[model samples]
Target: MQSTRKVTEDIRWVGCNDRRLALFENLFPIPRGVSYNSYLIMDEKVTLMDTVDASVTHQFIENLDYTLEGRSIDYLVIQHMEPDHCANIEELMRRYPNMEVVANQKTMQMIGQFFDISTEGRTVLVKEGDELNTGSHTLRFLMAPMVHWPEVMVTYDEKDKVLFSADAFGTFGALNGNIFNDEIDFEKDWLWDARRYYANIVGKYGLQVQALLKKATALDIRMICSLHGPIWRTDLSYFIDKYDKWSKYEPEDQEVAIIYGSIYGNTEQAVNALALRLAEKGVKNISVYDVSTVHVSDLIAEIFRCSHLVFACSTYNGGIYPPMENLLADMKALSVKKRTVAVMDNGTWAPSAGKQMIKMLEEMKDMTILDMQLSIKSTLKQERAEELAAFAQQIVDAM
Candidate 1:
């Protein structure tokens, strides 16, 4: 088992992001990969924040053993019931039958439905403003409904001033040694993953996010423990501010994300043309990322921050490119709202990428599709190339 990473004096990074995994949900490139972060807070009664993926059950057990030398877990707090975080809930129940599962009504419903993880024997339902006493520590449950998941709730620790936030304000990349926001290099360590996590995971519920933000405004949060990223100990406001911006779906700059999944060079060529036009258009922060080459998580992160998103796809299985298709599905699932988007499609005899994407965008709201999609038949010509350039110019102009 991998060594457990102790995040703070009382917290530990008991889970890891096998960065080697190429796909998330069997589809998106996790890139910096992912972490099923579980924490063991050696507080008053020794609370466990969450659990890890079932695949890493052995590692999780070992980390748990190390964390709880002689101490026993009195409370296993289930902040989110998503399989990634709650798959081991039953296993934990079996191991510690006396341990209480602290969660909300929605979480219990999900548990019973999915894993049949019954709280009949051991359950403690927390309400919107309920506090649980653990001797020296006071934990407050803040209901964050639909901020990614309906069952999602954040536990506030007044003693450590830590918010055991499940998925809120989390990032992607695996941590090196540092867990606190102040511990890592802000530019390199956290920025990319923060953007990716927010864009891909919690992009949908901007309003709920606003509500949660408003709710937390009164609390003096000193630390943030998220399910997928490192724990924030110092300068936690940095993450809060990022969540504020990302959830709003506001553009970070006049930049663009050129995403393409090309089997041949046709779609790539179109992307190249677009990139060239973007350069010619005096766009300074333009970036072209190949969906096939880069992870969708990173691509999503870029999309959330950029003002414009341009997609070029080589028709695959009669729709968007495989990687591009996965990216689109991820975007749709995240329920992205309010973004300017454009697309390009490539085909040998059948041209469906453009029309297909247009239809998909219809399912999305507040998305302004630019007036055109540059389509190429098998290959592209100077005229088609010029059309691509024109589209890029239009995107820049819109920005």
Candidate 2:
């Protein structure tokens, strides 16, 4: 049902959706929906840089047919082999018998494995710096290994100064009929999910991304056409700057992400108390997330952003609390590194929650444990609340 929307002069977004996969459309907590962005370049010869999901191949063809009435597709560039992006490649090629697939060695292997497409010497295998020219438009490929996939490559178009960046600057939510960053609330809706996606999916590929960034800076890029989400036709630097920081595993700001696990309401009160204290102390930014509520991926993103992290848990099974323990385990598995740590636990019988949390966070790299652990007995007394507030103060001061 999607159209071949023109994002730029020569660049038309022929991307389609997987609404059945997504939970909501154009909203936060993006559940089932995904966007498969395909682009058409009109030059002496035409090339389709990518294709939509197989689920929407019919609609995709309709869009392509509309966008390209009499022109024949000369090339089909396969950048990533993830099924959502490459599922329709075979169908597309079948529809355009003369279309030659341009991909890397790894991509060809994946193409053969994922579908019935025969490499059969019909592909134009490209290397790291290989270029493809369609008379007017020139495309330069950059290998991006482990930026979510090993076979992934990003294309830079010299004529339009556009980088057809496959999934590099993508996010979850579908656009609201406007395919630019300026059209949406970048700070509120997309930023966190974008960070979460990068952290969870491309977290380990910082070095590869660093290499790609260095190579890309040599070009005059005016826009970025990613395989998902909106095209970067305006203010491209914001996404690039974010990539640099996230790739470095550097904190996005001075904010603190407080993830708390509350058994009853006692531990929750302590977390709320600390959050209010942070707000009252004039520390502009803080995230007080319930481990019981927030997804672990989102938690990981916040951990990436905040220089300070706090955990509150209630005792269970004569051992560490469950939620906090799970978060810590996930963090360790992700190989997370950050600035400071704070732990608050509530244990009526054995005071093991605080001790366990402190031990786990102490093991994190480049992490300086704040010398404060608030362990509550049965309930939060007035005195304990004051102490928790002071503890929150100490964390703010340390930050």
Candidate 3:
């Protein structure tokens, strides 16, 4: 019935996991599913942090109702007004007739845009540095505009030292009954999904995230209660450092990732050759992905994780391959920069993809494209072995 976990003595994680949904935001695939976390703070006022998606309304309401024990919700704080977290606002209001919606002005406007309910008298409008005292715990609202959303704000509990991070430190996986980060092997199991989630969802707003991180540095936060993924109660710096590096567009590892767009496996063969060359040159942890087979979100996450990148593609219809072009467009859209890149192209006639890919990469900030461009006609011939060796040497030297 009520599938919930206790976050602290007063806060209960009344959230729901959606394993049936194939995609997150109908874009990225979520094989591990995702969690829509909504926390309920049991104080004298009985405040609810946020609401879950409509898809899980039944489970969410069951958990909320069981945790409330028939007590009414005095306040419903809206951290981020995104549909996934705000879908049940109207339903919540109907269930608890006197519950006041707590949010910033922009969130209030969005609430009006999304729902038909009247917020004339049943709204608590908060601003930056505003505090709400719900009996024992005091929640201080911090405005984090453009941190993925313009109206986003994070709440800090003064008593328990918990930060109700809206979506800042979130990941893309179900809780699996282990709601806390320390309960599971986070670094081994959850880091990749977390990277994918941040790189795709919040990668575009690095400056805003940096600002939020700056604000968080001043507060003595002991726990992070995000609206998705597990709660962080121990070793906070390990995750915070990751957020810091990700928000700054820094590579997580000094490694090479070779991504290829191959139509008939020709370009893929060339990528494999280059990866072998890199390995022979003492390069470790080299990652290779097929642009056509692998999801763009996964590629983007790899691009974010690796410091060095190799883009090998086969020219199609006298242009760059579709998958490779799409990946480059996504890289630009997400403001991906500050990395070293190498380009290789294969064509039966004219291999213009190498130059075109370089032009696209040049549009981004602080991208270092290697001068050793490897152009192959259909395949890597034996005569070009010397040239390939030289190209690999250039990359190793640059590293």
Candidate 4:
């Protein structure tokens, strides 16, 4: 009952897909499920790239057992210490008693913290620009300190020119038997989840990602094997360009997104009107979302994609709506910046959500808040048509 795929003549993919898990890290919803990718390189010294989560330990072991075919693992590379990727290190060590754990200094320390094992002579401590030779294939270790984790590093295979990227180009969603990017229509089905994954998980470490990309540029990489989602074996630039743009905090599309938090539907109605006005002005890439209904991770991903944003909310107890506030907190936490934003608030008594939201946005980096603010009392009445028109015009002019 082994499910495996071949990356090349010598490399085999032994990853597992989890469609039963409800959330990723118990925070973001993964309706499409997620994949825990682990690769095995067969050479003079058989090496296992990484291990999968404990939830899929049975399947992972079966895949490894079948692929190994009685040959013991010679080396276990620990690229990241996250539980999801490093859950069965002890199990793996126990299974291959003579196998050595190859990792950096920080990762070695984390091994002691996470498991009851002795790395006295069973570890190969590496640093930047270190190389490990397993027969003809040589893996060069490049330090990527905070690509998302402090102990992160990527391994480059000299023989096959495959980069064993830990999590840099990873996405959310289970692989439906299509392991390579060329096998599926990645732009049509997988881009959104990829954006969400990067925005929420690796978005905070933009500078570190940029550094990693620079290091990768020196290597002639023909394939990317991450510990999550699909492997890239063709048109590597397609995904690498995405990583470059995302790490630079640049919008992938010159689009506008209107996110609103409405209590009794008034605020949502106002957003609808604004969206139509923008459409009339020939803004074709406009998207509307109800923050109360959508997850903050989705909102953050949209915000990251769009160059312009509109936050429409209803004030509650003289403060910004809770969901809208939560979205703002996530944006700030993820280092979201370099965009234009417009604010709208509706409140029967003391309409202060607009000002409060503006205050919060001001604390972020490189955010351009439109000078025009629309304050609605209970509802946006017909008499305020001219004011609403002016507000929409301001956004159009900025765009």
Q: Tens digits of per-residue lDDT for model 3 on 1-399?
A: 999888889999999999999999999999999999999999999999999999999999999889999899999999999999999999999999999999999999999999998988999999999999999999999999988799999999999999999999999999899999989999999999999999999998899999999999999999999999999999999999999999899999999999999988888888888889889999999999999999999999999999999999899988999999999999999999999999999999898999999999999999999989999999998788889999998889878
Report RMSD for candidate 3.
0.7
Q: Tens-digit lDDT track for model 1 on 1-399? A: 556776667666677556666676675566677777888877768888888888778878988887788677889988888877888888888888778999888988888887855678688889998998877778899999887898899989887788888888777776665656677786576787678667766787888999999989889888788887777777777778888888787777667877887896877877887787788878876788888888667777787888788888888788777777777777788777578888788899897888888888878778899997788888778766567667777788788
User: Evaluated with lDDT, which candidate comes out highest?
Assistant: 3
lDDT string for model 2 (234-276, tens) is: 7888999999988887888888888888877788887887888
For candidate 3, what is the lDDT? Answer: 0.95
- Residue pairs clashing in model 3 are none
For candidate 3, the TM-score is 0.99
- Model 2 earns a TM-score of 0.91
lDDT to native, each model: 0.80, 0.81, 0.95, 0.94
**Candidate 2 Cα outliers beyond 4 Å, as residue runs:** 23-32, 383-386
If scored against the real structure, what TM-score would every candidate get?
A: 0.83, 0.91, 0.99, 0.99
Supply candidate 2's per-residue lDDT for 98. Answer: 84
lDDT of 4 by residue, 1-399 (tens): 999999999999999999999999999999999999999999999999989999999999999999999999999999999999999999999999999999999999998999998878899999999999999899999999987899999999999999999988999999999999999999999999999999999999999999999999999999999988889999999999999998889888888999999999998898898888889888897999999899999999999899999999999988999999999989999999999999999999889999999999999999999999999988889899889889999898888
Q: What's model 1's TM-score?
A: 0.83
